[model samples]
Target: MIEVHQFACLSDNYGYLVHDRASGETVCIDTPDAEACLAAARARGWTITQVWNTHWHPDHAGGNLAVKAATGCTITAPAGDSARIEGIDRTVDGGDTVTIGALTAEVIAVGGHTLGHVAYHLPEAGIAFVGDALFALGCGRMFEGTPEQFWASLARLKALPPETRIHCAHEYTQSNARFAVHADPDNAALAAYAAEVTERRSIGLPTVPMPLDRELACNPFLRADDPALQARWGCGDAVATFAALRAAKDGFR
Candidate 1:
């Protein structure tokens, strides 16, 4: 079986370490804080062997070199963002596959947070390590990709099995819930979800690995194609609605 260890790093980023029990191989899913990641692995008695980067963003890939220096881990990064990323042993794009021990993860192109951003989906494990592309109740800011591109990327994620567990990078759910409620006020599912998020936050709980099905039903960004959201946002299509929502979120607070 494969085991995942999720820990808080930096200020709000969540770091992940994927370990394959049979082969004792471990993979770091983005290096937010090098020391934290290294120490986490050391404490678990697991030696890191690979680093999988999602994008070129400093917070996501900044610690690659240090982690490599500490573990001699092979680094795999997205080809589109390879120019800016460091210590990349292999640069893969969408449709490619990477492995750890016996488990294989499909590299999904989920750009839009950044033009080169990618996500790692381990179908066999029913989980995806999505950087900032898709969040619990929100999506990442449209940093470098077109709205059409972003919506298309989100569509790819939507196509995944509903039961897939989405592991996003940040602890932004509480804030996102507020925006989600404002974005789709009439959604009962979203309202219920927001209430649950509030309760979770009140108790200081982490809400990173959200179920995709719940996100599908509640996240306004993911529901941009729904007719009600299109009408409410005054958009004609998914791309337009997504663009409007992203813009609204940019100025929401």
Candidate 2:
């Protein structure tokens, strides 16, 4: 079994520790806060041996050096943006496979949030750790990439099996849910999910890891191809539809 331990770090950011029982190895995905990540691993009695980063964002990779120094962990990060991330010992891109113990995780290049953003997917484990690439009802803001690049990145994720669990980096689901309902008011699934999110947050719950299938049905960013949304935006091309949705979401509050 792959044991996943999630904890809050640096405001809305989340840190995850994936422990492979078979190999007695542990991998920490992203270092939002070094102390928090190290503490979580200590609490589990697991010594982190590897640190994998999704992008070069400070919030994501800021603690890389600190964590690696503390645990002697090897740091693996995106090759495309390796220069920006501190202390990256191994650089990987899409199509590369990383391992922790007996488990294998495929690295997928998912630019847009950052031109070199990546996601790590363990197909057998049915999990993907996506840092700021895809979020629960929304996608990351276009920072260094264009809408076309981001649209393509999203397609890479959409092609994954619907049952895959998406472990996003931040807790933006509640606000994203509000925008999702606003973008596609007729979506019953989104309305229902919004209600559920409201309840979850009301009791201080986290909604980071959500099923891909649920996002496919209700997330407006993923539903850009829907005829209804296409009609609303008066666009037929998927990229255009996505751009329109992004613009609407940018101004949605």
Candidate 3:
């Protein structure tokens, strides 16, 4: 069986360590904080053998060198953003596949947050480690991609099986819920989800690793293609609706 260790680090970032029990090989999803990641792995008696980077953002890849120095783990990063990233032993594109012991992970091109942003999907494990490209109820800001490009990237994620567990990189669910409710006020599912998020946050809990099916039903960003959202946002197409919703979220608070 495959095990995933999730913990909070660097203010709002959530770090992940994926361990394959049979092989005793561990993969660090990203290096938000090198020390935190190393300690977390140590606590579990797991040694990180690989680091898979989703993007080139500082917070996402900043600790690459340190982690490599400590573990001598091979680093795999997005090919498009390789120029800005450090300690990359291999650069992979959207269709490439990476392995951790016996587990195989498909590298998905989800480049809305950054032109080189990628997601790792282990279909057999039914889990996806999405960096900043996606969130529980929201998505990363359009730092370097266009609406068309971003929407297309989201479509790829949407195509995944509903049962897949979405492991996002941040603890921004509560803040995202506020904007989600405002974006799609009439969605009862969304309203209930927001209330649940509020309750979860009130007790200092993390709201990541959300179910993809729940997100499909409640996340306004994911529902940008739905007729209701398109009509409400006054946009005819998914790309435009996504753009409008993203713009509104930028100024929501």
lDDT of 3 by residue, 1-253 (tens): 8999999999999999999999999999989999999999999999999999999988899999999999999999999999999999999989999998888999999998999999999999999999999999999999999999999999999999999999999999988999998999999998999998889899988888999999999988889999989999899989999999999999999
> What TM-scores do the predictions have?
0.99, 0.98, 0.99
For each of the candidates, the C-alpha root-mean-square deviation to the true structure, in angstroms, is 0.6, 0.8, 0.6
lDDT of 1 by residue, 1-253 (tens): 9999999989899999999999999999999999999999999999999999999998899999999999999999999999999999999999999999988999999999899899999999999999999999999999899999999999999999999999999999989999999999888998998898889888989887999999999999999999999999998999999999999999998
lDDT of 2: 0.92
Q: lDDT winner between 1 and 3, please give it.
A: 1
Candidate 2 matches the true fold with a TM-score of 0.98
Highest lDDT: which candidate? 1
Which candidate do you rate higher for TM-score, 2 or 3?
Answer: 3
By lDDT rank, best first, the candidates go: 1, 3, 2
lDDT on C-alpha atoms for all candidate structures: 0.95, 0.92, 0.94
Tell me the tens digit of each residue's lDDT in model 2 across 1-253. Answer: 7999999989899899999998889999999999999999998899999999999999999999899889899999999889899988899999999998888899998999899999999999999999999999999998888889899889999999999999999999999998888888998989999999999999999987999999999998987778888898799988899999888888888
Worst 10 residues of 3 by lDDT: 199-208
